[model samples]
Target: MAGRVLRPVGVITETARRLSGANLHERIGLKAPPGELKRLADTFDGMLDRMENLVGAQRRFAANAAHELRTPLAVQRAAAEIGLAGDPPPEKVARIRTRLIGVADSSEHLIESLLLLAVSEEGLEHTSPVDLAALAATELAAAEPGAGPAGPPQDPTVVRGLAPLTVAGDGTLLGHLVRNLLANAVRHNRPGGRLELSTSADGVLRVSNTGPVIDPADVPRLLEPFRRSAERRHTAGEGAGLGLSIVASIARAHGARLAAEANPGPEGGLTVRVRFPLPEGPTPAPDSIRLPRN
Candidate 1:
């Protein structure tokens, strides 16, 4: 009887000692007879599995972040090196200045995106009634001045479905979500492409853009950090591939459902829709309002 108890204890000690330096990827688990000892072994194994998953996720995130940040830094370094290499004339200095400014702008955008992503990971702390439709309109309007001739069609049409489509969430975060969506829509669109923004009484917000067709299979990967679709390759330096990922993160933080669908046609485009749960209260009247055609 004494040896029986001591034997199990001895086995547990030896198992733990052997596992101390063992590779976490091996998924090694202890073997014990049916009883409290078996339950203990199972619990230990489960913990190891969870730790492995967490470590793996952290490693991936670090790798992706390093890769994304290196581009702008490299651009900045090259610009500085070229500028200092010679006594450049006024025209050359101006050109170099412009290049540096572009690099600076890109760096600023990347930092802001990284901060937003970090905040999203922490989750939302406060919530209130927010008018997503109005927010969408405001963001779209703010984006107009930056929408150059090379961007989406000038004077893009606007179609409003439901007025005061309110959702319960952090107003600032929700604004960021809307802005990112609208920015992506305009940024990826063709010159003559059309953008449509609409909201439903059911608490659904949709932004659709007529641009390069995206593969349905690639949509999932596009939402991951630092992952971009084939269409984005040509416009590589314009963005750091965090727009949609940040949008997805904010949506998740707000407990909203986000879905991306490819447009139906050979020309190809993408529509992103986010649906939020209705707050407790009377639903607003559904009205169709269309802005004057641009």
Candidate 2:
């Protein structure tokens, strides 16, 4: 009996040593005879599967980060090269200046987004009761910079919120989540399009925007880092495609559920809803927060 048990252990040790040289992306599962050794083998195989998935995700994230960073750097380099080539006329100089400034702005936004994503992955540093409705109102009042000037002159957002709708989470991260959602909605909207933001006392936050019709299948991809719709790709300064992904990350950190769907109509759109669980204690006072009706 001792030899049988010891044999399985010996085999597992040798197999592990042999496979240790394999890359993280490679999955080499172990097989064992029926009995206690089989259970150990199954557990080891499950662990290998998890490690593979984690490594795969990290690899994709690294590749996407490099690609996103390269674009802005390339723009800046080209602008510098053009400016250095010769003494340009006033109009050309002004154009170069504008291009450089735009590149700088985009780079800054990308860096900020990356930092937020990294910090969120590590987990929230602080936690408190945050009023989602009031936070949304504040973000709405302040127009997001660098969203491009393509939309209609008039603001198109409709806000319907219940006061004192709060959740226990890090204020900074929660605020970021709200701002990202709002910015995304405004940036993607068409000229004279409509945006609806609503928050309920039950800890539900919904942001819906009118834009080009999106395929239902594409909605999931939109929540991944560095994923953008074809239309958004053409629109300069829209964003680095990290808005919804960061929002999703922040929501996960706060234990909230995020649901995204494409709106149904001739002019299609997207709607994202985040449902946060209420705190365990007493609730705050009720106050209605409404934006000016369109």
Candidate 3:
């Protein structure tokens, strides 16, 4: 009888000692009778469940980052090899130079985004008041002059409902969060679509745009790094595909909730809302909250 109860306890400790990324799939799976030992076993297995998820996510992130980096590097190599071969003409050389510069810029952007995502996930190191309304207005104005994301149609009719809404967080990350929301609005919108921006004292910042129809089921996964719609609405040449992902990360760092939904009517787009926590305490982290598609 002494060995019986102690056996499961020993198994639990051994499992934990040997647990690693490679062995996260393993579990003690203690089959002992109901009691303290069995409960402890269940608890240990539950911890492994959470650990498996976290480790899996980190692995996926690293793989995605590698793939994102490889594309730009490949483009640069191709431009160098093909464009400079056999002493190409002056015009051709100029085109190659421009292309290389553009590729370099895109690579830089991707690297910065990857680093920012990591930092945001690690939580904020500094906290201050960040005005969502002001940031929204600034980004919208920047997007209005055809500075919107690449490959989008004519500028959308932007309507603003700005109010002085400030939240406590890292100001720089908050600014990026706002910029990404506007950029996503424009990038996914149709020609002559509407981009609506609104903020209120409740610490809510809302952005809606008209674009291609998105599946309700796909809204949640859009928050994943490098994730894109199966419809291929945004291609590899488009932005780094981190816009919504970064927004999600920043919101998480600020202890806010981020949600997105498909817009109504024939001109379909997305409506994303970020609700910041009151200064009293951090809101619980919301990994995949989204609005019902209409």
**Where in model 2 is the C-alpha error above 4 Å?**
1-15, 18-22, 25-39, 144-159, 231-235, 282-294
Q: Which is better, 2 or 3, measured by lDDT?
A: 3
Ordered by lDDT, highest first, the candidates read 3, 2, 1
Model 3 lDDT-worst window of ten: 229-238
TM-score of each: 0.76, 0.82, 0.86
lDDT of 3 by residue, 182-203 (tens): 8788777777789899998988
Comparing candidate 1 with candidate 3, which one achieves the higher lDDT? 3
**Candidate 2 residue-wise lDDT, 34-66, digit = tens:** 777777877766777787777777778899889
Instruction: Please list the Cα RMSD from the true structure of every candidate, rounded to 1 decimal place.
Output: 9.5, 8.6, 8.9
Task: Please tell me which predicted candidate would have the highest lDDT against the true structure.
Answer: 3
Ranked by lDDT, the better of candidates 1 and 2 is: 2
The candidates, ranked best first by TM-score, are 3, 2, 1
Worst 10 residues of 2 by lDDT: 20-29
Residue-level lDDT for 290 in candidate 1: 52
Cα lDDT over the full model 1: 0.77
Full-model lDDT for every candidate: 0.77, 0.80, 0.84
